[model samples]
Target: MDCETGFCKNDVQCGGAGGRPPASLAEFTLGGYGDQDYYDVSLVDGYNRQVTIEPIEGTFRSTGGKYDCKKAGECHSNLLLSCPEPLRHLNSQGHTVGCNSACTKFNTDQYCCRGDYKTPETCKSSTWPVNYPKYFKDNCPTSYSYAYDDEKSTFFCRGSNGRISPDYRVTFC
Candidate 1:
């Protein structure tokens, strides 16, 4: 199948090479952080498709009234249709194929959360020329829209000590 991102040079797997940019990602750190699996659908690299990471059969905890384990993604939203003109990734046919994050499109310190803005305190999206991260967050509420979207987008589940490991269902749309 043809793909704008994550093409893998016609191979089924990317091997050691990373997928192309503007590809949605379901990131995971299994059995991490207090023996809980951490997972998220990150749009920080940009968004080529709708993605969801759902954990199956795990003990979920609540921290400060927020559930640690739950579904994370933008399964219902087709970001290509709503992508800003400056961040729109187009196919050969000139159709909108993906939506790039401000960092991917601009490559500036401010948008990328690097250089002087390397720290979260200095890299606030509200300080940008245009609040581009807000655009992604507004559309994909559950996904990581920017570099420091941990509070809203990161999820965790406990599956340790002979407990059944949670199977993740990653759905791409």
Candidate 2:
């Protein structure tokens, strides 16, 4: 797999190091708080490609009927094709390689959700001068488009008897 981002210089594995920004990410925390497996497909760093995470088997619940332990991220849409011009990441060949987040492209407090926009209450993507996250969310509904997309983006699965966590299948394109 030759990744446009996360390409480990001539190596197959990253060896614990993280990939660069402008790449789709499958984030996971196994045996997290409350013995649950938390997972999400994040585009907060930007989107180089589409990615998905599917839970194999587990005791799933929607707590308050809010979240579900289902598939996350995009399996179809190609964000690069629809990337905004200002947020488009170009390669040496002048081709669009990735779709960068407004925060990554502009580096503003409002877009980055930092400074005064640090809190969830203040960091509403809808309030931005240009809602860039909306582009990602509208295309890939299950992905984490920005920093505070937790209510819709975060997903978790628990064991049947607190003994087995669900295995996940992460696919990238």
Candidate 3:
């Protein structure tokens, strides 16, 4: 994406437009508040394919990196290998493959972050079926693996184009 008035400084030092950092489609500058952007990548639903997001440039602290449904760069997301046995999805070939969340896999209010577990504390990653949340989190630190995921799953980039609001990108690798 192109910004007409500002710059997006990617925290990781990827090459941004005209020497500024950017998100999936915009650029920014760092000195102003109105020019800031925030973003997140989520897998709270499940994993089916691959995806990669790398910051290309900027002066902000965003320093983007790569993550896929299967792996972060060459490091495996480990969904298929470490996902809870009950939450595993298989292909027609009957091989263990993708994985779903406890909420989707079991439809439980506790795991789905509904009912009594509406708060972040009630629906924590450890309260579910095994360490399933960690299964995804350990694989993709930049993405959400469960209902209560915060801070660690969010990212920010400086926006200098004098624009507000944010953008998101979901690509399959």
Candidate 4:
């Protein structure tokens, strides 16, 4: 019934008496960057699988970074924030498609808008529909917002008008 840091116990034998050694544990060390911190984690498994997790943190350094908004709608006017690199072509559902090259630059008036585009019309017609969720459209609508919740290991989004919305979820990649 014993387990390590990132692993749980699995009993393959009868009565869970004599099983394998407790699974290897993973530990993390973090380094600070401005107001952000990056992490390095050591992972071990019973199969001798050892892995390292690094570069686990991110933040906007640009003074005019529009993506740094505290709420979704607030990100609309800043030209510095655009679709995340992996999310450009994808829609709110996270499906991938080719997006407009001009989309590389932030456009509050465009289909992808700041956080999420308003109507499904704004989303479905652009790359957002294929890759993102409908909630993104409903919540974000105009601008993009960002917030960090350390307890949940999560980042939340909001709209230009400072309305909180569900945008993207971040996990180990």
- Candidate 1 lDDT for residue 131: 95
lDDT (0 to 1) per candidate? 0.82, 0.84, 0.52, 0.26
lDDT of 2 by residue, 69-164 (tens): 788896346888989899988887899998889988899999999999999999999999999999999999999999999988998877564455
The local lDDT score (0 to 100) that residue 64 gets in candidate 3 is 42
Which model scores highest in TM-score? 1
Model 3: worst 10 consecutive residues (lDDT sum): 19-28
**Pairs clashing within candidate 2:** none
How high is the lDDT of residue 74 in model 3? 21
lDDT of 1: 0.82
Task: Give the poorly placed runs of model 2, Cα more than 4 Å off.
Answer: 1-3, 8-17, 58-66
Tell me how many residue pairs clash in candidate 3.
28
Cα-based RMSD of the predictions, in order?
2.4, 2.6, 12.5, 19.1
Kindly indicate the candidate among 1 and 2 with the higher lDDT. Answer: 2
